[model samples]
Target: MQRLLRRARIPPVRTAPARTAPARTATVRTATVRTRSAAAGTAPLGLLYERHGEPAAVVQLKNLEVPKLGDCDVHVKMLAAPINPADINMIQGTYPLLSPLPAVGGNEGVGEVQEVGRRVAALKPGDWVIPADSGLGTWRTRGVFPEEMLLKVPSDIPVLCAATLSVNPCTAFRVLADFESLAPGDSVIQNAANSGVGQAVIQIARASGIKTINVVRDRPDLPKLVERLMGLGADHVVTEEMLRKPEMKYIFKSTPRPRLALNCVGGKSTTDMLRHLQPKGTMVTYGGMAKQPVMVPVVSHIPQSAFIFRDVRLRGFWMTQWRREHAQDREGVVAMMDALCQLIRGGQLTAPACTEVPLQDYRTALEASMKPFVSSKQILLL
Candidate 1:
């Protein structure tokens, strides 16, 4: 990274002798001044939303002030940020984490360190980094952030991988490993099987030798979606209807009853997956794409044995909350990222299907992100 940065660095211009300016010298100095102003004089452009509403209606592209660098600050040139469901929810005033009005509207992205303040030690110019937590206002061209707020990542990983890493993939990995004591050959089930976190769950589970029963809403392109999940190492893929049918038993024949059920789509989808968990199993809810409450019966709605005797556990996770709990544990975050990076390097992990859209074309990206059955993640290139 340092070598590449050295090669790309523009040589400093030599000053002409201090004297009365000739036409050519005057032109040179004026041009130099303009170049410097362009590089550092202006504020950066960002996607800002002044009032909470539909993301498309409220979010606007505007110039944002370049904050003064503090002794512990790191100046960064953002490379890319993804349009996530949480980002949309934050814009719509639905999510728990909302910045003040006129807030820049992104929570996840990767950036290149341009310069470091005097007291900043760990991060240097040319390093790749991501926000250590959410609500950092990442949908901008540049920023001056404190060193502790940024996590330095390996420069070799793909920008899209680094940009989209902190949220979904981390969520997936944590839920899979944290909630249950899953081992090789143990089965896990999840709804919204094609989402960013779901896809990460599939890959990470596959890498760990745990089987996954992926559930998705039925669509005309079911075969194609199933094929895509299969290619990502899913053990099985089924529709919401299929999950409710008697034949769900047939799936457990190959893999054991799942000990962990991951619920992203709440309502019936959550309850249905819960029915299949092994005795003393766990169900972790992290999202509600269905805009419905998780309905669980007190009595025998699920298989009476599973409900009465199964001892099923239910829990919830919020990445922002997790970040807050780990606020001072930056080393722990770095260690987790290091493990994820190792998987990335070994091809055990990969980014979701992403559609790169330039920052100026954010409307197109935001629109596509809300459309039904859209699988590819929308990434805004800065």
Candidate 2:
């Protein structure tokens, strides 16, 4: 039942201006709005950064103006945005590659189209949408981006899930498609089963009639964790200790060995997944939350027809790739949104637990989001 709080009485938050082009190459698609006149008394308030640095080092909530929009651009009023690990990494300059200095944070969010420039079609004011990551700065109260970068979402969809849809759901879909040759009734195993991506994989696979063997690090709240994932349609749940136990052999006595193993936790968890793979099976690793390189026994890769060992293959996925592969991936995204909405409406897909944070409380929100035991996601309401 969580919802993103959209407009406030405050003025819009602006962005760093786009670079100018040569006169010969420039096309005057629209009149440039006067920076001072257009903004007049309207001051922008946002989580601003003056440098590429750690979240704690440079990020601050301050007043600023809305960025200029081009003829084909649209201005979006942010509804709610999620504080993802990647957002923290981007702000920290710890990501594999960092954004330009002084850039705003956040990549996943839901927004309402507030205004559109001339020649803009397909979208109109009041439409709920998600901007493509190429647009990047969603933490602010508002943003301006080319219309092509916006993906429309139905108004009835839950804002919490809409804010999270772009990355986690896409990662889950891609991993399910890229990894092992999965078939109905076949089994897949994954660690970090309570994670956003893991939860999506469970639901998607279940919808396809595929079974799952979910693994998680042991915790005092294991029972609640199991209940949550099971509610999302998980087949079985086990702790790392249970998975590594010698007596656990008979548990797979009648059930088929997993053909696909999805690993998000590396190190020992990665090794654990490889041990559960059937002959000629595949283990696809997409994340390393354990912060350690995967350690695999050499024997797991030795080719043997019966227990044919193919080293677990590793692949990296980013939603940007999905967008690149299909320029209209947004349409597919909307379709998936429709599917998730149906599940939610029918009372099948329960809403993920979400905590709403005001734009000014980002620091506390960021700290809480980084905690090891927060349920589901933390959302920033504009």
Candidate 3:
């Protein structure tokens, strides 16, 4: 009887509620497996904008959270970016548009991609890139943004040079390329030859076999300045003061007559350039550093072109517009940069001296950078 009880004690195995839908309904399948989210890191390094106003309004270095990534995003570690005049103006809230509050302040930097989203196919970690726009907040040690806005930079190019490339070099390219009819034998004249854009234009024109007559403010190192420019392929180097010479026609006759002139400095500087331009020539103005309106003489009028009275037929060239039209020419841009790099490597291209500083030394660096005679372009290295 005890053995019979033991057998009966073993309960029958219970079956799952015969899941009328095969033990488990499609609606009641195992819970979906979740993939891990992207890892977050410490805050990035950068200059923050606590307020809006003047240069002293509030530019400070502070740690901030790494920006969150989007589906087509790229996270970059900024190597270096320059402090251009535009940057200063932007920070002072004097520029055409002000940056958002509590934003980072810097444009034109070179960086390495540290992370990329699944949808970002073109770039990968460790690849060097730059922003298409100079004002895209490049002062940070790291940032996250859509891949479409990034430009892959050549590894051979020096980081400092890469940092300054977006604005100046691109502007130089536009000035040279726009007047396609202007040829190698023709001469182009410009003021502010000491300016970054002016220097770039001289080099580019030299490379293209075009002649350039550069006009710069007289400096203590005038001789050296002239020598440097000549070495960069300047056909003739003159001072703006020379433009007012009563014997200007006699003096200009000995020099190449400029068929195309680039004027960035308005006021008296504009008149100076106009006086040297060959009749029917075109002058393109990209800036007005003189802080005065360009004044043209009434006698400059000629029947061939009414533009003369309008001051050498002035026209403005904006780099942003040029970039839009040539967006498809990324390869071309890369090629130009590569060619410049090759020249740099071959010793044919004289890279302007660079003043290196740490990323955190922006205030001092900025002060030195804005100084008129400060040697070399101030570069903030990460």
Candidate 4:
């Protein structure tokens, strides 16, 4: 099992040769100006939204004064931030947790510590860090945050990986670790297998010697996507249509019956996945991408039958609630980050495919993020 996990590792990083003077000059000039501004106490540029509505309609680029550092504050220079679906939902006033109006427009990203207040002890000027909680407004070039609201991460991880480490990867880890007491060779099934969280589950489960049966929506490029996920250690990749077929039962002949089922799309997609779960198995629902309530007929209601006869259990997980429950245990949060970082450093994990856009091109990035069936993540590079 350990050897299988190591065999699935990503290739080693490669360094690029130095660029020519013309290319290098622009980068050097920009760094010099940014450094001078930090020294002179100039305000940084931020994407601000005064009202909740469409992103392109409400979000604006503004030069806002940096807040005065508190006794335990740390000032950070933002590096990269990903445009997640949750960010879009929050901007549209639909997410479960909404920030007050006139707030900054991002929730996740990584930044470099540019300055630290006298009372700050765990962080220094060069340490890389991410927000310990949401609503730090990460879409800006710089920010000043309370020391307790940030978590330090190692500097060697790739910028994209660090910027995106918190939400999707952490969600995947918590669901897999907390719900089922999975052992080596235990099989798990999930839908929306092309999503960021789904991809993370595949790799993480593989590293733990657990098998995954991934189901994705069929698309024109279905073969390509299936190949891509298979390369990432997915034991089996099937379309939603395939999952509903009678022959799906043959899958268990090769591997053990799935003891854990993960549901992101709630409707028939979830129902189909549930049919394959072993007796007394558990299913954790984290999302409802289908935007439809999970319903089962009275005569064949699997939830009722499974509960009464098989002892099947159903539960829901929300990362925000978990964080709130564990708020006082700062050490526990740090330990989770450490474990995820070690996977990245060991080449056992990598960020989802990403497309980098400059902060000024945010409108384009936002549009790209909302497109149907878009696979690559759009990241805003500060």
Candidate 5:
């Protein structure tokens, strides 16, 4: 795995700061099915980063060498992967789960099982799969990986759905299930309402007969965003300012107060949503997009104390940690995936709005993902 080597057809190597030893141990054997890549027949190329900083600056497209396949290894021909905020954070070394330097930069993607080692059982040729854990270095043309790191998914779903499924959707599913037991007609509120997780939450909640109060920052194109989210089953889409206003009471005239508040944006945005929560409601803090400390009002303005008066519960959720604690419940994970796929097949859930870019054009995609008011997810088509 540490060898500075490439396949026989690969061109001579050049000195580069991002250059690292080729990954895994594998020699490609003659196979009946090959991945769709114009750049195939040459060494595999991946987005490699030598240091932690801005992802666009330190990452480079470089040739790779996969080592010989072990009996439990699976050779996957990469397909499509999304450029998620977590991926950017991991590249910058701010994310809790970071790959080693000179490592591939993707954390999630779907790929074809072009070949599986003799001992591989659950997956076979042509099976579409995604990584079960992070740090598999998904932003590459192909790679050989241990079988345990992969999870097979149905191919009938759209490519974008399978590619993006392993992260945001899964997170949404867990958050809804693990938190307050929300029933049909019950409502939940969330900020950053157009994010990948937010979109997933809207759809999943709708499928379960729950209503969602979606909140987003006021942007120039607010109407369009609200329309799109409402089309995806949002019961109400309000700007942060609108949520703060006294007129917010009218939003609850038709539906009940939310017992669950999903706060991805910390600071006042969280407080805005928190104020709307039903007494004893649970607020789950996930991502701090606003980059500010949460300010909860405990003064008599609310007619009672914030924490002691309302008895609102504050908690945090990290998907990686959930997976770790539930390691023994592999069956539970599979069942969740199966339920999500069923939702996809029934047309109850669809892929998030996506812009597919070929692997070589990653820089453009990464830049777009970092911009404000961005709704479409950037997917790299390998």
Candidate 6:
């Protein structure tokens, strides 16, 4: 097994100061650290991990030989990749699926094809693409991957949206389309409404003429967050405290009871969200951000007049599983991507707020990603 490099730190590269610099040259010199060379070569720099551990501790910047392309393969030049929670969890060895040791560290990103094998017909140099599934190790500056493992993405779409389109937005789309037979004017309620999936849901739902009741935890910036979500087309935004109040009943007078509920934060939040669902409605659980188990109160348990009486259905959704089940359905995946890109190009969907850091400053990006209450997504730029 490959072991992690045990070096304590790798310092940033610096160039020697120029002699007799003009006053105007000072500003240009200060920005040198942020620029990167786009030249291609046998050795390229990448973020790598030889073992599972804290991202800051285990991940290191190293020079790696560019992977050689094989028949039916393409060499991709990474444009931008996001640091996601799942990427962090994979680094911690806590995710359900783990890659072999000495792995590259990102799952989703957008890249341009730099070269294609002679046998490759569908793609060529300069075409934009994204990994067909997770574990393609997208953080590197470039990689050679099998043509089948990538899906073409429109270059016209914003780089951020294209980079992130395969995961969260797709998750939101699947959860809405797969589970329920929804119609215009129908309403859905969901907690963690300030999340990436939540924002996608709000915009997608709005475009389909569906309504959304967004639930979020209260914070010092609660008002601003609510306004932001509303600006994204949420029908209503309520805090967990507001959801528990009897006054919430007034909200239903205008909007019909939610036909579906999406849960990310489990524990009390799940139970409270269930309380607002229409009888015989379905609740889909996608994440457990609160690190609490989904518990059903004994007093309102199924034996009594609770879940069974209401004919409520509980289901779980994992994007990885969905990909596996539909791996061979290439047309389906392309259609979904097309819809999302159209939404983005049409201005109906917007990428989440983001902070970009050059690939060399990954340590700072990793630290920021782990901070609590961080609303901006971190993207590593080449």
Q: Give the local distance difference test score of model 6.
A: 0.80
Mark the 10 consecutive residues where model 4 has the least summed lDDT.
25-34
Off by over 4 Å in 6: 1-42, 297-305
- For candidate 2, write residues 1-382 as lDDT tens digits: 0010011111111111223323342111111111222342365455666666667768877654676777998888889998888778767766644555556677788899999999898889999988665336778777777887778877776778778877777666656665454667788889988888888788877766778899988888889999988888988889999998876577677557888788888998887777877766666666788899977676434532223246444444555544555564455555445655555555555445678998878988988888886666888998
Model 5: pairs clashing at backbone N, Cα or C within 3 Å: 24-67, 25-67, 25-68, 26-66, 26-67, 26-68
All candidates: CA RMSD (Å): 14.4, 9.5, 22.1, 11.0, 11.6, 15.0
Q: Let me know the TM-score candidate 4 reaches against the reference structure.
A: 0.87
Compute each candidate's TM-score over C-alphas.
0.88, 0.82, 0.81, 0.87, 0.89, 0.87
- The true-versus-predicted C-alpha distance at residue 292 of model 4, in Å, is 0.6
Off by over 4 Å in 2: 1-42, 300-312, 328-351
Give a tens-digit lDDT track for model 6, residues 1-382.
Answer: 0000001111111112223423331110000011134454445667888788999999987766664678988988999999989899988988877666677888889999999999999898989999888888888887788888889998998999988888889888878776677778889999989888899999988888889999998888888888899999999999999999998899999899898899999999988888878878888888999999975443565533336677777777878767766787777677677777878988999887789999999999999999876767899996
TM-score of 3: 0.81
| Model 4 RMSD in angstroms | 11.0
Error at 131, model 2, angstroms: 2.2
Clash totals for all candidate models: 0, 3, 0, 0, 6, 0
lDDT values for all models: 0.81, 0.69, 0.68, 0.80, 0.81, 0.80
- The regions of model 3 sitting more than 4 angstroms off are 1-42, 246-255, 300-311, 325-350
Which runs of model 5 end up more than 4 angstroms from their true locations? 1-41
- Please list the residue runs of candidate 1 whose C-alpha ends up more than 4 Å from where it truly belongs after superposition: 1-42, 305-307
Q: Sort the candidates on TM-score, descending order.
A: 5, 1, 4, 6, 2, 3
Top lDDT: which candidate number? 5
Model number with the top TM-score: 5
Q: How does model 5 score by TM-score?
A: 0.89
